[model samples]
Target: MADMSLGPGLGSSDTCRSAARQAGAPRVLLVIPCFNEEASIGGLLNEIAAIGRGYHTLVVDDGSSDATCTVASCRSPVARLAQNLGIGGAVQTGIKYAARQDFDFCIQIDGDGQHDPRAIEKLLDAYRSHPTNITIGSRFIDHSGFCSTPMRRAGIRLIVLALNGLFTGGRITDPTSGMRLLDRSAIAFFARSYPADFPEPISLAWAMRAGLTVSEVPVEMRARKAGVSSIDGIKSASYMIRVLGYILLARLVRAP
Candidate 1:
């Protein structure tokens, strides 16, 4: 049997101790942006809680017109949004909350199951050690166990390659991977001006423009357990175009 007693402050004893172990390591917030993701949210939250690290999860329920809010609310400390804010806004909401609450770092994760909770430790390890540069979970680094459609994989590779050339002047390997860890500097940066739509790509460029160091760490990706992707096929093409245009626009603006 699982520990039904687990919720927010109750199980965070382990996380608090773990946080103490690192001495200077930032307090971590695992931010999940959800839209009608009740099926996977509960399991995902429990899995992350099982990590035994002092990690708190915030589910920015983006106006999920389903059991998502109800189910999430039953759990402890899961935040919710009153209106559909889309992915970008949902994530930004969580980020802002994390910043305001004075968390040391925030890990942006998809509410869908495409991101593996187990890989979180690897990203955290990198972030803890580096203490600089944003750590992104890249699914294309080794490609040993990740599963995705061929077309989507190809599209991601192309986008990653282009992103490397255009922004980082280096290869990203997984440009669209939603799993990422941001330090306090990054957390503050984005809390002020996160992209409103399709933020993963645009935010990368924005981080770079702010002279924040960025790096990718290898992580195996998973297929979503339920719910259709917000972006696919033709949507990917449109997203690429829109982000590319936004990148150019962003470059024109002087850094704050």
Candidate 2:
């Protein structure tokens, strides 16, 4: 999508010539943020590699207390966070890396395997077709039979409704969905000021506030292959309130 070769050739410089020659690859980085997701990280990395896009996958361990780092290290090009930073921190670290490396784009997928590597093409397609927009994967857009528990679905709906209100005209079906693709401009914005917690919705609001193009494409999501959700039960309710509050705060802070 969008000239898969969106940035400089893999090795316009001699340093990366070998990497470039090994694969006539595009300069894309798949940033998977992990929190104790050892069981699924291996499978996710292998699947992403199979996409055959010369796109490198980097796992930010997020201070996972389990075998996450070991599993990730077994794979090349993975970055580990020495301490457990929350999701936002881990993702911000990835964005900074992507920006510094001059990557054309960065795709954020879950380390839990709920996000499908196959959808990488769709994200790339969306980004290519709408070069200026940030493409978010929306599970509810056409709901190709993927199942979400009723309670979880309800919470997602509530968040989307609130997000639309705050943003005035934006319609987002999955405000908390972790799967997203960001072009260079979007990446630069996130690298500098990503929200510390409950970032997806807040980031969307921030993007719209800055008059950036933001869009969503429908993608099927799989159930988590392993590990409990980082936000659920009491934590889910707490996070919902926290995320909603952040959305309001973002709107207020941006208002004239």
lDDT of 1: 0.75
Clash pairs detected, candidate 1: 15-53, 15-54
Write the residue-wise lDDT of candidate 1 on 66-143 in tens digits.
887667666636666667767888888778877777777899888887788888889888876765557889877787
Residue-wise lDDT of candidate 2 within 149-196, one digit each (tens)? 776777777788887876753568887779999898888888888877
Give the per-residue Cα lDDT of candidate 2 at 8.
22
In candidate 2, stretches whose alpha carbon ends up further than 4 angstroms from where it belongs are 1-26, 145-147, 168-170
* Candidate No. with top lDDT: 2
Worst 10 residues of 2 by lDDT: 1-10
